[model samples]
Target: MYEDHARIPPPPDGGYNLNALKPGNIRHYDYWPEPPGPQTFGNTQVIFSDHEKHMVARIRQADAVFGCMAWLTNYAILDALAGLEAVQIVVQKEDFLRPDGPGWRKTKLLRAYKALDKNLMRFNIPWDVGSCDQCGDPSIEGVRCMGVHNSGRKSASPRMHHKFLVFCHLADGYPEPYAVWTGSFNATWNGTRCRENSMYIESEPIASAYAQEYGTVAALSEPLDWQYAWVAPEWRIGS
Candidate 1:
């Protein structure tokens, strides 16, 4: 199993070569304005080019399918999820809250909300939110937005702290799962259109670990202590 710490790479440069003593280190490296192509990494080069065609062909021929478990700190996964079939998501309620206005504002979040809305309708899936007390929020749609409250701990923009978890099962037999630490990313056009890195693991052990975390979240999401202010709008309207 890959430990959490192992997944993150060490910083590129050791903290600052304080001693200007190393002669070779004084050589200046030219900065490239554009990113390098696929040849940047050996593994990516092999995967993207025809040089490893035979090995790629073999992987495609394997009867076993592909599965994924991804953890996204930003909205990077939104684009990836667009091509997928089905997904189950766990997220803080604040992640969906975008101030209503004009322009390209909350477009991504709106898209995600719409997609989620459509999937729930198509699958007849039931959705629920734990009471505010258990969720550590003072309110849901009110002053204390669930999405914002859960994600506010480490973020500068409370808007980016939306907390939510999502799971999607593709129709092609392969399954894709995702777990987000913060519920900030919206599923709108602008939300996902950016430069960000989302980690994906095709290993079963990694996927299972993520699934286990999902279960834990679900079990603890029930709101037993807090009183319901009103039925969820979605539930009330039967949308």
Candidate 2:
């Protein structure tokens, strides 16, 4: 409904002035000075809102955030997530792929988090390694395939496909989620351009339930004691 990342309309004449607000100037995590409602383009009604800017704005309001997406390659969202005070991101270990010779390799997502931050630590349980015996283990080379029966490692390959974000505010000196964003919208370039639906639910009960689900996923992210080598070599204090 909105413009793609590559096709975002130009900013105002002087460009975005973070210090001062001006008409038609779009600043990160701020209300649009003049929002353009949906426009009728021939037979289609298109929304011109800046989805990335809106998402970043919501993220900036949270003291803590949690997200899980099947596919995530949006750099803007990644930067915003990293800036959060406290955050946990879960994603399919098999999805962050880039070409590696004839095979595929880990994307910058892994290195970006491990070397600089500790928030995006959890790995979704891999359910994509279907029929490894026939097609071979799809896990990137050098990375251990938890599902493969090599020496003594045997892990479950269950589905973990979820696309949602939970935003929490501090309550009683502890973080408590007040809202959740969930839908089929993945945090990827193609995902933003595709036709998808999302929900921004603001309910104490629902948010808390999502928070609990996030906790469960984070706790049981990888197979017991079998960490995804791409995330970190070994667990640390907070991880």
List model 1 lDDT by residue over 1-239, tens digit each: 31232222334753321111122222253222332223423212211222122222332332221111122223334333333333344343333343444545366545543442212221122222221122232222101211223343564433223223333343354334322221222333233432322222234445445555543433223121122222222212112
Q: Which ten residues in a row have the lowest lDDT in candidate 2?
A: 140-149
For model 1, the run of ten residues with the poorest summed lDDT: 138-147
**TM-score (all chains, Cα) for each model:** 0.36, 0.53
lDDT string for model 2 (1-239, tens) is 32232223446763432223333423353344554544544433333344555567778878767656666567687777777655666565452332232322344645444432432213321112211222322222111111212233336544457777778875543566788877666777655555555566667678777766655544434422343433332222131
Alpha carbon lDDT at 218, candidate 1: 34
TM-score of 2: 0.53
User: Residue 42: error of model 2 in Å?
Assistant: 31
For all candidates, the clash counts are: 30, 0
Query: Tell me, what's the RMSD of every candidate?
Result: 13.3, 13.7
